[model samples]
Target: MDKRDLVIRPIRAEDIGAVQDFLFTQLQELFAQDGQAAITDDVWGLGKTYLEPDNCNMWAVFTPEGTVVGTAAICAYNGRIELLKGRYHLPTTAEVGRCYIDAKLRRQGIGSKLVEAMTQFCKDHGYRTMYLHTHHFLPGGFNFWQKQGFAITIDQGGSLEIVHMEKIL
Candidate 1:
Protein backbone atom coordinates (compact mmCIF):
# COMPACT_ATOMS: atom_id res chain seq x y z
CA MET A 1 0.00 0.00 0.00
CA ASP A 2 1.11 3.53 -0.59
CA LYS A 3 2.41 5.24 2.53
CA ARG A 4 0.77 8.41 1.34
CA ASP A 5 -2.59 6.71 1.49
CA LEU A 6 -2.51 6.15 5.24
CA VAL A 7 -4.23 8.78 7.38
CA ILE A 8 -3.71 9.36 11.06
CA ARG A 9 -6.33 11.25 13.07
CA PRO A 10 -8.07 11.34 16.42
CA ILE A 11 -10.58 8.51 16.64
CA ARG A 12 -14.26 9.25 16.68
CA ALA A 13 -17.05 7.33 18.42
CA GLU A 14 -17.76 5.45 15.22
CA ASP A 15 -14.23 4.14 15.07
CA ILE A 16 -14.18 2.51 18.51
CA GLY A 17 -15.11 -1.01 17.48
CA ALA A 18 -12.55 -1.23 14.73
CA VAL A 19 -9.84 0.23 16.91
CA GLN A 20 -10.53 -2.17 19.76
CA ASP A 21 -10.50 -5.17 17.45
CA PHE A 22 -7.20 -4.09 16.00
CA LEU A 23 -5.69 -3.65 19.44
CA PHE A 24 -6.95 -6.97 20.76
CA THR A 25 -5.59 -8.86 17.81
CA GLN A 26 -2.21 -7.25 18.14
CA LEU A 27 -2.04 -8.03 21.87
CA GLN A 28 -3.11 -11.60 21.27
CA GLU A 29 -0.39 -12.13 18.74
CA LEU A 30 2.22 -10.80 21.11
CA PHE A 31 0.92 -12.98 23.90
CA ALA A 32 0.95 -16.06 21.75
CA GLN A 33 4.64 -15.57 21.19
CA ASP A 34 5.70 -14.58 24.72
CA GLY A 35 2.98 -16.31 26.77
CA GLN A 36 2.21 -13.09 28.65
CA ALA A 37 -0.35 -10.43 27.96
CA ALA A 38 -3.15 -8.49 29.51
CA ILE A 39 -5.55 -6.47 27.44
CA THR A 40 -5.88 -3.40 29.61
CA ASP A 41 -9.16 -1.85 30.69
CA ASP A 42 -8.45 0.98 28.30
CA VAL A 43 -8.50 -1.46 25.41
CA TRP A 44 -11.90 -2.78 26.46
CA GLY A 45 -13.28 0.66 27.32
CA LEU A 46 -11.76 2.99 24.83
CA GLY A 47 -14.76 5.28 24.92
CA LYS A 48 -14.66 5.77 28.65
CA THR A 49 -10.90 5.73 29.18
CA TYR A 50 -10.03 7.81 26.16
CA LEU A 51 -13.03 9.47 24.59
CA GLU A 52 -14.69 10.49 27.84
CA PRO A 53 -11.64 11.89 29.60
CA ASP A 54 -10.97 15.53 28.92
CA ASN A 55 -7.21 15.03 29.08
CA CYS A 56 -7.09 11.71 27.26
CA ASN A 57 -7.28 10.96 23.58
CA MET A 58 -6.59 8.14 21.09
CA TRP A 59 -5.52 8.39 17.49
CA ALA A 60 -5.80 5.71 14.80
CA VAL A 61 -4.05 5.32 11.52
CA PHE A 62 -6.61 4.42 8.91
CA THR A 63 -6.17 2.86 5.54
CA PRO A 64 -7.90 4.37 2.55
CA GLU A 65 -10.62 1.83 3.31
CA GLY A 66 -10.91 3.19 6.89
CA THR A 67 -9.57 0.07 8.60
CA VAL A 68 -7.65 0.79 11.80
CA VAL A 69 -4.06 -0.18 11.16
CA GLY A 70 -2.40 1.61 14.03
CA THR A 71 -3.28 3.22 17.38
CA ALA A 72 -1.70 5.27 20.19
CA ALA A 73 -3.26 7.04 23.13
CA ILE A 74 -2.64 8.96 26.37
CA CYS A 75 -4.70 9.11 29.53
CA ALA A 76 -4.50 10.77 32.94
CA TYR A 77 -2.00 8.99 35.21
CA ASN A 78 -4.63 8.36 37.91
CA GLY A 79 -2.14 6.81 40.33
CA ARG A 80 -1.20 3.80 38.30
CA ILE A 81 2.31 4.03 39.70
CA GLU A 82 3.24 4.90 43.27
CA LEU A 83 6.67 5.98 42.07
CA LEU A 84 5.17 8.78 40.03
CA LYS A 85 2.79 9.97 42.73
CA GLY A 86 5.43 11.92 44.66
CA ARG A 87 7.31 13.22 41.67
CA TYR A 88 4.43 14.41 39.50
CA HIS A 89 0.86 15.44 39.96
CA LEU A 90 -1.44 12.71 38.71
CA PRO A 91 -3.67 14.95 36.66
CA THR A 92 -0.77 16.60 34.90
CA THR A 93 0.77 13.31 33.79
CA ALA A 94 -0.32 11.28 30.80
CA GLU A 95 0.20 7.53 30.50
CA VAL A 96 0.81 6.57 26.93
CA GLY A 97 -0.20 3.15 25.61
CA ARG A 98 -1.92 1.09 22.94
CA CYS A 99 0.88 2.06 20.64
CA TYR A 100 0.82 -0.62 17.96
CA ILE A 101 0.96 -0.80 14.22
CA ASP A 102 -0.22 -3.68 12.07
CA ALA A 103 2.71 -6.10 11.64
CA LYS A 104 2.58 -5.86 7.91
CA LEU A 105 2.68 -2.09 8.21
CA ARG A 106 5.48 -1.81 10.75
CA ARG A 107 8.54 0.41 10.17
CA GLN A 108 6.71 2.63 7.76
CA GLY A 109 6.59 5.60 10.20
CA ILE A 110 2.98 4.96 11.22
CA GLY A 111 3.95 4.43 14.86
CA SER A 112 5.87 7.69 14.96
CA LYS A 113 2.88 9.55 13.57
CA LEU A 114 0.69 8.12 16.30
CA VAL A 115 3.20 9.09 18.97
CA GLU A 116 3.54 12.55 17.49
CA ALA A 117 -0.20 13.00 17.59
CA MET A 118 -0.36 11.89 21.25
CA THR A 119 2.52 14.20 22.22
CA GLN A 120 0.76 17.10 20.58
CA PHE A 121 -2.37 16.21 22.44
CA CYS A 122 -0.46 16.19 25.72
CA LYS A 123 0.96 19.64 25.02
CA ASP A 124 -2.44 21.02 24.11
CA HIS A 125 -3.96 19.54 27.25
CA GLY A 126 -1.33 20.98 29.60
CA TYR A 127 0.28 17.70 30.55
CA ARG A 128 3.77 17.97 32.10
CA THR A 129 4.92 14.38 31.68
CA MET A 130 4.20 11.27 29.66
CA TYR A 131 4.70 7.69 30.88
CA LEU A 132 4.49 4.22 29.34
CA HIS A 133 5.58 0.65 30.00
CA THR A 134 6.60 -1.87 27.38
CA HIS A 135 7.63 -5.46 27.83
CA HIS A 136 11.18 -6.28 26.74
CA PHE A 137 9.76 -9.18 24.77
CA LEU A 138 8.28 -6.93 22.15
CA PRO A 139 10.74 -6.50 19.33
CA GLY A 140 12.19 -3.01 19.07
CA GLY A 141 9.63 -1.68 21.52
CA PHE A 142 12.17 -0.17 23.91
CA ASN A 143 14.43 1.16 21.19
CA PHE A 144 11.46 2.70 19.42
CA TRP A 145 10.47 4.70 22.52
CA GLN A 146 14.09 5.73 23.04
CA LYS A 147 14.18 7.12 19.55
CA GLN A 148 11.08 9.11 20.43
CA GLY A 149 12.93 10.69 23.40
CA PHE A 150 11.61 8.46 26.18
CA ALA A 151 14.16 7.34 28.76
CA ILE A 152 13.99 4.32 30.99
CA THR A 153 12.85 5.28 34.47
CA ILE A 154 12.50 1.74 35.78
CA ASP A 155 13.14 -1.77 34.58
CA GLN A 156 11.17 -4.39 36.47
CA GLY A 157 13.14 -7.50 35.75
CA GLY A 158 11.04 -10.60 36.20
CA SER A 159 9.07 -12.85 33.88
CA LEU A 160 7.92 -10.02 31.66
CA GLU A 161 10.76 -7.61 32.28
CA ILE A 162 8.51 -4.58 32.11
CA VAL A 163 10.44 -1.45 31.24
CA HIS A 164 8.82 1.76 32.38
CA MET A 165 9.67 4.75 30.25
CA GLU A 166 8.89 8.43 30.52
CA LYS A 167 9.24 11.65 28.55
CA ILE A 168 8.98 15.16 29.92
CA LEU A 169 6.66 17.14 27.77
Candidate 2:
Protein backbone atom coordinates (compact mmCIF):
# COMPACT_ATOMS: atom_id res chain seq x y z
CA MET A 1 0.00 0.00 0.00
CA ASP A 2 1.14 3.54 -0.66
CA LYS A 3 2.39 5.51 2.35
CA ARG A 4 -0.06 8.26 1.43
CA ASP A 5 -2.87 5.86 2.26
CA LEU A 6 -2.18 6.18 5.98
CA VAL A 7 -3.31 8.98 8.29
CA ILE A 8 -2.58 9.64 11.95
CA ARG A 9 -4.90 11.74 14.09
CA PRO A 10 -5.76 12.57 17.65
CA ILE A 11 -8.10 10.03 19.21
CA ARG A 12 -11.60 11.20 20.06
CA ALA A 13 -13.85 10.16 22.92
CA GLU A 14 -16.02 8.01 20.68
CA ASP A 15 -13.00 5.96 19.59
CA ILE A 16 -12.43 4.73 23.13
CA GLY A 17 -14.83 1.83 22.88
CA ALA A 18 -13.37 0.54 19.65
CA VAL A 19 -9.84 0.90 20.99
CA GLN A 20 -10.73 -1.03 24.16
CA ASP A 21 -12.37 -3.75 22.14
CA PHE A 22 -9.33 -4.07 19.94
CA LEU A 23 -6.99 -4.36 22.91
CA PHE A 24 -9.19 -6.94 24.62
CA THR A 25 -9.41 -9.00 21.48
CA GLN A 26 -5.64 -9.08 21.10
CA LEU A 27 -5.08 -9.92 24.77
CA GLN A 28 -7.59 -12.73 24.56
CA GLU A 29 -5.85 -14.28 21.60
CA LEU A 30 -2.51 -14.04 23.36
CA PHE A 31 -3.77 -15.80 26.50
CA ALA A 32 -5.68 -18.46 24.61
CA GLN A 33 -2.49 -19.55 22.90
CA ASP A 34 -0.95 -19.96 26.35
CA GLY A 35 -3.92 -21.99 27.66
CA GLN A 36 -5.09 -19.14 29.82
CA ALA A 37 -8.19 -16.99 30.00
CA ALA A 38 -8.58 -13.37 29.03
CA ILE A 39 -7.59 -10.73 31.53
CA THR A 40 -9.91 -10.03 34.44
CA ASP A 41 -12.37 -7.14 34.68
CA ASP A 42 -10.15 -5.35 37.21
CA VAL A 43 -7.25 -5.32 34.85
CA TRP A 44 -9.45 -3.96 32.10
CA GLY A 45 -10.70 -1.32 34.50
CA LEU A 46 -7.17 -0.21 35.20
CA GLY A 47 -6.57 0.02 31.49
CA LYS A 48 -9.58 2.24 31.14
CA THR A 49 -8.22 4.46 33.87
CA TYR A 50 -4.97 4.81 32.03
CA LEU A 51 -6.76 5.76 28.86
CA GLU A 52 -8.82 8.39 30.58
CA PRO A 53 -8.20 12.00 29.61
CA ASP A 54 -7.01 12.94 33.08
CA ASN A 55 -4.34 10.28 32.89
CA CYS A 56 -3.22 10.16 29.30
CA ASN A 57 -3.03 11.66 25.85
CA MET A 58 -3.94 9.34 22.97
CA TRP A 59 -3.78 9.20 19.18
CA ALA A 60 -4.98 6.78 16.55
CA VAL A 61 -3.59 5.74 13.20
CA PHE A 62 -6.13 5.14 10.50
CA THR A 63 -6.18 3.88 6.95
CA PRO A 64 -7.45 5.96 4.10
CA GLU A 65 -10.70 4.03 4.39
CA GLY A 66 -11.07 5.35 7.95
CA THR A 67 -10.34 2.12 9.81
CA VAL A 68 -8.58 2.58 13.10
CA VAL A 69 -5.60 0.31 12.62
CA GLY A 70 -3.19 1.48 15.31
CA THR A 71 -3.14 3.41 18.58
CA ALA A 72 -0.53 5.10 20.80
CA ALA A 73 -0.70 6.95 24.11
CA ILE A 74 1.41 9.15 26.34
CA CYS A 75 0.93 9.22 30.10
CA ALA A 76 2.03 12.36 31.95
CA TYR A 77 3.03 11.85 35.54
CA ASN A 78 5.50 12.72 38.25
CA GLY A 79 8.14 10.43 39.72
CA ARG A 80 10.69 10.75 42.50
CA ILE A 81 13.61 8.86 41.11
CA GLU A 82 16.85 9.76 42.87
CA LEU A 83 18.64 9.89 39.56
CA LEU A 84 16.55 12.88 38.51
CA LYS A 85 17.57 15.04 41.47
CA GLY A 86 18.75 18.54 40.55
CA ARG A 87 18.64 17.73 36.87
CA TYR A 88 16.75 19.37 34.03
CA HIS A 89 13.62 17.32 33.45
CA LEU A 90 10.13 18.32 32.70
CA PRO A 91 7.77 18.32 35.64
CA THR A 92 5.31 16.77 33.24
CA THR A 93 7.34 14.24 31.31
CA ALA A 94 5.31 11.96 29.12
CA GLU A 95 5.63 8.21 29.00
CA VAL A 96 4.62 6.40 25.86
CA GLY A 97 2.35 3.44 26.55
CA ARG A 98 -0.33 1.14 25.16
CA CYS A 99 0.99 1.34 21.60
CA TYR A 100 -0.73 -1.22 19.42
CA ILE A 101 -0.95 -1.85 15.72
CA ASP A 102 -3.34 -4.27 14.08
CA ALA A 103 -1.64 -7.59 13.51
CA LYS A 104 -2.59 -7.53 9.85
CA LEU A 105 -0.82 -4.19 9.48
CA ARG A 106 2.36 -5.08 11.32
CA ARG A 107 5.68 -4.11 9.62
CA GLN A 108 3.95 -1.56 7.45
CA GLY A 109 5.62 1.37 9.28
CA ILE A 110 2.36 2.22 11.04
CA GLY A 111 3.81 1.74 14.50
CA SER A 112 6.80 3.92 13.77
CA LYS A 113 4.62 6.67 12.39
CA LEU A 114 2.30 6.51 15.36
CA VAL A 115 5.23 6.83 17.76
CA GLU A 116 6.71 9.74 15.90
CA ALA A 117 3.39 11.49 15.88
CA MET A 118 3.00 10.98 19.62
CA THR A 119 6.49 12.34 20.28
CA GLN A 120 5.76 15.39 18.22
CA PHE A 121 2.53 15.90 20.11
CA CYS A 122 4.44 15.77 23.37
CA LYS A 123 6.85 18.39 22.18
CA ASP A 124 4.02 20.62 21.08
CA HIS A 125 2.45 20.31 24.51
CA GLY A 126 5.60 21.61 26.17
CA TYR A 127 6.90 18.31 27.41
CA ARG A 128 10.67 18.02 27.50
CA THR A 129 11.19 14.29 27.81
CA MET A 130 9.46 11.07 26.85
CA TYR A 131 9.90 7.61 28.26
CA LEU A 132 8.60 4.08 27.88
CA HIS A 133 9.11 0.59 29.29
CA THR A 134 9.13 -2.47 27.09
CA HIS A 135 9.70 -6.15 27.58
CA HIS A 136 12.66 -7.74 25.83
CA PHE A 137 10.40 -10.52 24.57
CA LEU A 138 8.70 -8.25 22.04
CA PRO A 139 10.54 -8.71 18.75
CA GLY A 140 12.02 -5.49 17.32
CA GLY A 141 10.63 -3.16 20.00
CA PHE A 142 13.96 -2.50 21.69
CA ASN A 143 15.68 -1.87 18.41
CA PHE A 144 12.83 0.25 17.14
CA TRP A 145 12.99 2.56 20.16
CA GLN A 146 16.76 2.79 19.86
CA LYS A 147 16.47 3.70 16.19
CA GLN A 148 14.12 6.51 17.25
CA GLY A 149 16.88 7.98 19.43
CA PHE A 150 15.65 6.73 22.81
CA ALA A 151 18.37 5.47 25.15
CA ILE A 152 18.08 3.02 27.99
CA THR A 153 17.77 5.22 31.06
CA ILE A 154 17.00 2.62 33.64
CA ASP A 155 17.09 -1.15 33.93
CA GLN A 156 15.06 -1.82 36.97
CA GLY A 157 15.84 -4.67 39.44
CA GLY A 158 19.23 -5.34 37.87
CA SER A 159 17.75 -8.06 35.69
CA LEU A 160 18.43 -6.14 32.46
CA GLU A 161 15.07 -7.69 31.64
CA ILE A 162 12.45 -4.96 31.52
CA VAL A 163 14.03 -1.86 30.02
CA HIS A 164 12.99 1.75 30.56
CA MET A 165 14.07 4.08 27.81
CA GLU A 166 13.95 7.85 27.48
CA LYS A 167 14.39 10.52 24.83
CA ILE A 168 14.72 14.25 25.36
CA LEU A 169 12.36 16.16 23.16
Instruction: State every prediction's TM-score relative to the real structure.
Output: 0.94, 0.73
- Residues 64-126 of candidate 1 have per-residue lDDT tens digits of 999998899888887757755676678788899889988899888888878888989999999
> lDDT for model 1, on a 0 to 1 scale?
0.87
Q: How would you encode candidate 2's per-residue C-alpha lDDT over 27-75 as one tens digit per residue?
A: 5654455355543452255346444645467777767776677777786
TM-score of structure candidate 1: 0.94
Could you tell me how far off, in angstroms, the CA of residue 110 lies in candidate 2 after the best superposition? 1.3
lDDT of each: 0.87, 0.69
Model 1 / residue 82 / CA error / Å: 4.0
- Candidate 2 stretches with Cα past 4 Å from truth are 1-3, 29-55, 64-66, 80-90, 157-160
